[model samples]
Target: MVPTYLERFGDSVKFELKVSLPQNTLPKNTVYELIPSFRYGSQVYAFDKKLGFSSDSIGPYVSPQTKASFSMPYRDGMEKGRLMAYGQLTHQKTGKSLKTGEEVLAEGIITTSELSQIGQYYIDESIPVMGLSVKYGDQDAYGMYKDGWTELQRLFMAYSNLGFAEKSEYMKVIEGRGDFSHKNLLFMELKDYDKVRKDVLPRFDRLAAVSMATTEKSEMEIALLSRQIRKGEISAALLNEAELAAAVDLEPGLGEKEVLLKRMCEVHPSAFSFNNLGVVYLNLANRSLDRTEKNRLLASASEAFDQSNGFFENPYAAYNIGLVYWMMGDKASAYNAFYRAMAITRLDELRKVHEAALGAVSIYNGDYRLAVIHLNKAEKNEINLFNQGLANLLAEDYYNALIQFEESAILDISNGYPFYGMALIAARNGEEIILYENLSKAVSRSAYLRKRAPLDMEFIRYHDKVGFKDAIR
Candidate 1:
């Protein structure tokens, strides 16, 4: 029979204290609460000492169907689904640790009282252990799980045989023989890593994608937060799996870009939101035709990027802000933005983008020499090569300019910019036939270039020519 005092305390005989979750959200790798014995002695409690269960609390939210997918905040990197839980067992009134039996730990992180400690009474816990003599079935879990149905059936049977007092992690806190409310604080790692990945994660990813795509705003957030927990850079496979259930794009359906981003920001305030919001705004700006609206979108993009900088000093965000300035035709601001990004960015790949942006801004600013220097530093690519040629042409370096344009042409046969560069060179040398041939090819490929050619100063001499009018038309 349980004592009246123990009944009133919900048999909190084991619980010295329990920490409430912050905003009802589970945190990873945090020491939630200390569990000191309320009674000072070498006695081991059943729930506390033997099994590690405490009083009633909400079990972590898990999927009702699969029981795998849950609201666990995907911890970054190696911390995903793993933690080193630490705790100490101290006396209730003596204020000293009880070093009894063998000090054990979930991962040896807890300062368990050992043989070395003075004035520490070892509390012996009587617990049964079970192990299979032959290690059961196939040692290679992957090969065994390939026969998944059979393997899981055998595994479940094995688990049932291994018992802990006919009671599961569920413990109710009532006065009589039972408690109405129950809770489970224990978590387990999947023993067969490859097996779980092959069988479980795909289903979870499918759910993640569906939740993210649906009109339901609340579920969409949890799905995105789950995305942030990948140990490595997210693979296309996982994203593809998630997209299978989506009928429409997640971004537009949510709401206006700013409103959607703000809601996301409130739910999950991470660099992921800040960076992606900048991108969405930048894309919106590009799509808008009205100049004032475009500028307004660019301003929003810049602000999103600026907010991202508050989370982390990222060159990706910096370059995006620079791009917004460039599109708005603010050459000085664009170059300064790129230069600032370039100075702080240690990654060569990101630095290349910053350098190329600075080069393009220099071309527009009429700083041909600076443009050449910046363009040369950029990674060799069709776009950068074409821009380099443009800068060289402005500086009257036709030989270097032609070489750059020809290389750009070879890299991307479909792009018309390189041919346009060659036409400019021919126009400078008074080669009308050669100039008109290249100009025709350039105009046929690019609508914008075709529209601009007739009014271009470089093509002024050819504007009156029949071939030029034909190409422009």
Candidate 2:
């Protein structure tokens, strides 16, 4: 007779067994018997009448264990969401049986959304696993296996979703002195800053106050919030009041705060706090009305920039110093600083510095060809088109200059420099219609640019012209 067969369906198995009786049975006491057996990997399971009554048990007993056959159905192998096994039925007395074919079933292909859901399920399941493992296992073993796995999965999933480095960063949180829960919560909010600001910022402000009741908790919260701001997720304005309050809470006076900031720069040179202090000095220089104060602040800015360079050769620091020198009218020093910044960084802002410095140097040195070369390179960056237009004006290339200026003005409607350059170019070329239109636009765009036009050497020829003066004003 043919052997029995089993079919597998998603974590369950069903099998059919066939049993045949002996050709002759002598007496009523003769045993008619069969035992169902299953094999999965190396483990074997059997169903027999002697083992005790089971719902899956089959066959009848008789005086003698006769050669008989019977069919039995079974549901077995219930772990790991998979089933792989074969089945058979044998005579207990004869120890002989018919074979069944192997059957297997498995799960494959999981979507990202499904994986996320599965991860959540695993996290939830881990709580029960932790309870069970703690109850059964020793403390150290439970910590290493069950609780560790749960924590690892939670942290890894959290970090991965937030685009953070995913290589077991949970250990850092565990080992660190600060509150990891608050840190993780802040990280989640920072991952979607606009969403958080819209939905959670107000709540966060209230929570921040509660956090600040303790020094250690307050410092950790501030540090995490600062990281988000530095990453450009949260606006600086959003934290302005909070930061001021914290500063006042921690230290009494603004002067003392400045001193502490300086000390912070010294202690954590590689931190962005040092670069930010340089920015503060640069901002002060920009606002100073007294030439002496402006010069002193600019010098202070340069010192801060130098300090920043000691920790990290940040290009923006070098570029800001270059800007300070340019504002101080030290053209040579400005160009050298810009060149150094350009050499150190390939950032687009540094490219603008290179172009602006090159344009200024070329114009001062009377090398219009070099000015054009540098301006053209700058224009390629797309960000420095207005400066390129100004450089072209200095180079006396009116037609190309007008084109560059027009393109730049189109990109930023409020940019008046390009309009001013175009106006001057048009007036010098005796294009009265174009000159009046562009000059009017320039004056409309920027009152400051219009006021400064008389002092601008690039428009010197048109500055005294009655038509140009009337049109610009």
Candidate 3:
């Protein structure tokens, strides 16, 4: 590793480092960020216990640099030391992340689960950590600072996803004892900021607070309201839409959602929040463990969705309304909701969500043909394939269902539903041997399927068969 050169300009100090790396270390024509994690105080300057990361920039000749300025230790009496800036660089490829210039052995690399197990070794809680190797051609990185309230990797993803205002809001909240804009952040390239963010932004783990309506409520206010909600002092009337949404997630259990969300939609009346409220009620109904309360909670959920569609022509709200109605056993009403959802023009971000939702509701409403249409609109994946199989099965297109289920099973061998569908499809066609094989595979993966098989209507024709009994046994 080459030494990082330091220079002082006014109150801030700037430094740069250049280093060698493997041939073709970074793909050409792509942008990458040089993220630096910093530590302050005299204790760390002499030596710090945390494992440090040091790297020399690879191809395209990285000239990573940064600047820092620190005030005197304390405002009142005295603290320990002035702030310090530091960085660690790493390279990730095909599920391996190694320190700078460390060769990730081409074979028998660590699995994702193993890396997480390795992460368990981090007991310091104070030191930040890092992650995954994107598939080839997606080697991109962006800069983010980690500190209290935002050290989690998900926060970085949220920063990438947010608009300028939202990103600034997050930086303002988490930049404890520091400022970000003045920092001379270095990236390997200056391209794909928007594209990279778009590709990675809508990942499954979105930061709830960052994603919510923060323009109205600051992070501190939401934090305070969340504390009150957790402590059983949920004053729904006092919290705004964002706080109420956060409360929906923070509330210990199902009890507060009924009150909190109802009040939330009453005051704020956003289509999105109401759509979430519908989901919350659906969850409460699902978790009640009492069949008698299911219809009532579902009805309340449907009402919440009714209010949502009143606010905006939202496909998600309409789709959710359809889902609750179907659960309520009102098939015609569910169909109407699905109809409205499919008719509306959805936003780019919601197009796939809307397609997935409509496809699911179509199956519930017994519109198998419609289900197939909507499922086709969605991007093909294990879930959609399984849903398509369901649609085909119910529509009595046994051959098509068999093909979809077989494909879905290959995608997720451990998911019992696809195998279960295959078994039922084989039963419909009187392919006795195939039926027994898939039935055994399904029950082996999930014990619940073993119980459901005996009572399942689709398998009724072959229930008494000796093979069926033996497979479940």
User: Against the hidden true structure, what lDDT does model 2 obtain?
Assistant: 0.47
Ranking by TM-score: 3, 1, 2
Maximum-lDDT candidate: 3
lDDT, candidate 2, 403-424, per-residue tens: 8778877787765556767777
Query: With candidate 3 superimposed using the best TM-score fit, by how many Å does residue 372's alpha carbon deviate from the native?
Result: 2.2
| lDDT on C-alpha atoms for all candidate structures | 0.48, 0.47, 0.51
RMSD of each: 34.0, 34.0, 30.2
Worst 10 residues of 1 by lDDT: 111-120
lDDT of candidate 3 over 297-370, digit per residue (tens) = 78777777776556444555666676666555555676676566655533333355456656765665446788
Ten contiguous residues minimizing lDDT sum, candidate 3: 111-120
Pitting candidate 1 against candidate 3, the one with the higher lDDT is 3
Regions of candidate 3 where Cα sits further than 4 Å from its true position: 1-224, 229-240, 250-252, 256-259, 266-269, 360-367, 394-399, 456-462
Q: What is the Å distance of residue 251 in model 1 from its true position?
A: 6.0
For model 1, how does the per-residue alpha-carbon lDDT over 380-425 read when each residue is reduced to its tens digit?
Answer: 8877888888888877899999999899899987777788889989
Write the candidate numbers in order of decreasing lDDT.
Answer: 3, 1, 2
Q: What overall lDDT, based on C-alpha atoms, would model 3 receive against the true structure?
A: 0.51
